[model samples]
Target chain A: GAGVSQSPRYKVAKRGQDVALRCDPISGHVSLFWYQQALGQGPEFLTYFQNEAQLDKSGLPSDRFFAERPEGSVSTLKIQRTQQEDSAVYLCASSISGALGGELFFGEGSRLTVL
Target chain B: AQSVAQPEDQVNVAEGNPLTVKCTYSVSGNPYLFWYVQYPNRGLQFLLKYITGDNLVKGSYGFEAEFNKSQTSFHLKKPSALVSDSALYFCAVRGLQTGANNLFFGTGTRLTVIP
Candidate 1:
């Protein structure tokens, strides 16, 4: 893809429900990242992957938040037993280089509304 | 831990006038600072970064940021504001430490350019 693409641009989940968002990064991107953005806030780091290896998951807020980039191309973010506080936009980004200092290209983001 | 602060919740500027969005950071090691812009229903777009050497770093969309090591600040500035530039701006910081590659973002500043 020319740019990062995300699926389920908007999701409405009831309390305790599970939701999964998907991201397809740009072609040949070596680094992928996940972030959560609350209303009126900046994007918060959630996880990072170098190729298929998950190098950083320290930013995941809770046990309910999970992310995986199995093949190094596509990634998924899963939230289990969603809560009202989890309502926010989930963003995925990718960079051509594996280093974290490189410029990141972002997707349209998945807005999750936990009701 | 690395963190960034964007003190103002919003900044109002008139078109054709100069605009500035302030940002400050704290980190254990040398910091890598970045500025990104976000539009409604869209992903964040990287504006500029300050790594080494120069204090003033120029980036996309005629945006530039000054890296002040003394003040621990990296403020984004533009000589002329445009109504189309109205968006949300975020400041992020990444430290030089091995395990500190994850970016810590500020709470974002909403920029409103009046015509």
Candidate 2:
């Protein structure tokens, strides 16, 4: 892909419903990350992956938030029993290297509106 | 813990005039700073980063940032503002220590470039 791609640009879910968001990062990107952005706020780290390994999941807000990058190319974030407070934009980013200075390329984002 | 603060929620600038977006960071150790911009329905684009080099670092789209160690600030600046530059700006910081994989982002600043 020319750039990072995400699916379902917008999702409206009732409270307690389950939702899934997908991300296809740029080809050959080694690091994948997920973040959450509330209205009028900056993005917050959710999870991180290096290749197929889930190196960090400390940022996941709760056990309901689960992310997987099984193939190291495509990733998915699943949120179970969505709550109204979960209404926000979910962002995915990829970096060519996992180094501290690597620049992360982001996706257009998947907006989840829980009502 | 590493965190960033974007003091201004919104900034308005006249086209062709200079523009500035402020950011301050806090970290236990040295910090790796970065600036990113977001447009409507689009992903965030990386502007610049400050690692271990000089204070001023130039990035894409004629954007630049100054890294101030004493003041703990890394402000984004553009010599001339353009209407097309109107968008959301974010500042992020990461600790330079080992196992610091996630970047903490500020709340973001909305920049409106008036013509």
Candidate 3:
């Protein structure tokens, strides 16, 4: 792909249902990040991955939120027992630089709505 | 902690007029400032960043941001506004905050360019 790609552009999940969103980052990107953007709000950091290592996840709202990048190129964010407040656009971004100060390439994002 | 603030919820400007979106930041150490634009239904695109430079940084789409250390502000400015430039603008910052190494974004400002 020419840029970061995310799947399931829209998803409606009943309360308590589990949902998974996927992201495919640009080739050779060293860092991948997950963010949650509620309606009318800026994106908030969820987690960060450097290769297969999960370095920072202090932003996850709760234990129900989980993310993984097994192979480092593709990543998945799984939400268990989704709640109404979980509804937001899940954004995935990648950067060639691992530092937080560098520019990042972002995907279109997957919108998740929990009823 | 590190955080950014965008006080304006909406900004209106006439087409071809100069526009400015204000942003202020609070961080632990030095600040890594960035500006991003998000069009409807699309992911955020990076505009520019101020790492360690001449305080003025140029980015894509003829956008520039001035980093002011005294005021702790980084404002995005454009000499001429365009209809296509009407979008949500976000300011983000990263700092040496303990156990926090991700960019913290502001609420965002909606820019509307009247034709």
Candidate 4:
């Protein structure tokens, strides 16, 4: 089976520009999550989706960050007016369900560099 | 608040020697702990997790983690280190009682297995 995949492995954007990163979760996965990882730091939660519903977005750092999983399979994280501080890898993960014990499968992530 | 800490920035070990990566966590209720590994230019891969029951949990690639409630630690360990095992390791934790299923991750420990 194909693992979770992210597009545009690397993206360089100018400050104030908008960028969108895409993620394709594993087939049939019902739960999807997005995270942000800064250089030399751990990943921080961004948002979550159970099917088409955006369950949680509290982890999103700012209003500039927006995420959508409308169809429940593919997801996109869009950053508006990107800042140098937004430079980091955006990771996407999916799981079978939101059960207490389900494991998450992660993607390689899209590294975004804002200058 | 749920949080995780990987005390060490890096851990170096000789091949065939025992290796340990320290991880500590804090949460309001019972903690669901997990370990993940990331190689350079790659996505994170699930290593193992501790939900409940047994204190010792075995994971992929001959890795194991010990859950200590008293210490609030879930350190990853392996009897013999392999050169290929070198990578960035992250420890994550989530409160079982928290309605939102989000993981709090540590800064990550870079493990270097010298051959």
- Per-model i-RMS: 1.7, 1.2, 1.8, 1.2
Q: TM-score for the second chain in candidate 3?
A: 0.96
Q: Which ten residues in a row have the lowest lDDT in candidate 1 chain A?
A: A95-104
Error of 3 at B88 (Å): 0.3
lDDT (tens digit, per residue) of candidate 2 on A1-115:
8999998899999999999999999999999999999888888889999999999998898999999999899999999999999999999999998998888999999999999
Better of 2 and 4 by lDDT: 4
lDDT tens digits, residue span A24-75, model 3:
9999998999999999999999999999889999889999999999987899
**Cα miss at A52, model 4 (Å)?**
0.6
From the highest DockQ down, the ranking of the candidates is: 2, 4, 3, 1
Give the i-RMS of model 3 in Å. 1.8
lDDT scores in order: 0.91, 0.92, 0.93, 0.93
The alpha-carbon lDDT assigned to residue B79 of candidate 2 equals 100
Report the C-alpha lDDT of model 1 over A1-115, residue by residue, as the tens digit: 7899999999999999999999999999998999999988889888999999988898898999988888888999999999999999999999898664787889999999989
How far residue A4's Cα lies from its native spot in candidate 4, in Å, is 0.5
For model 2, what is the error of residue A36's alpha carbon versus the real structure, in angstroms, after optimal superposition?
0.4
Model 4 chain B: ten consecutive residues of lowest lDDT = B94-103
Candidate 4 DockQ, CA atoms: 0.74
- Note the residue pairs that clash in candidate 3: none
Which CAPRI quality tier does the interface of model 1 achieve? medium
Off by over 4 Å in 3: B98-100
Tell me the lDDT of model 1 at B95: 78
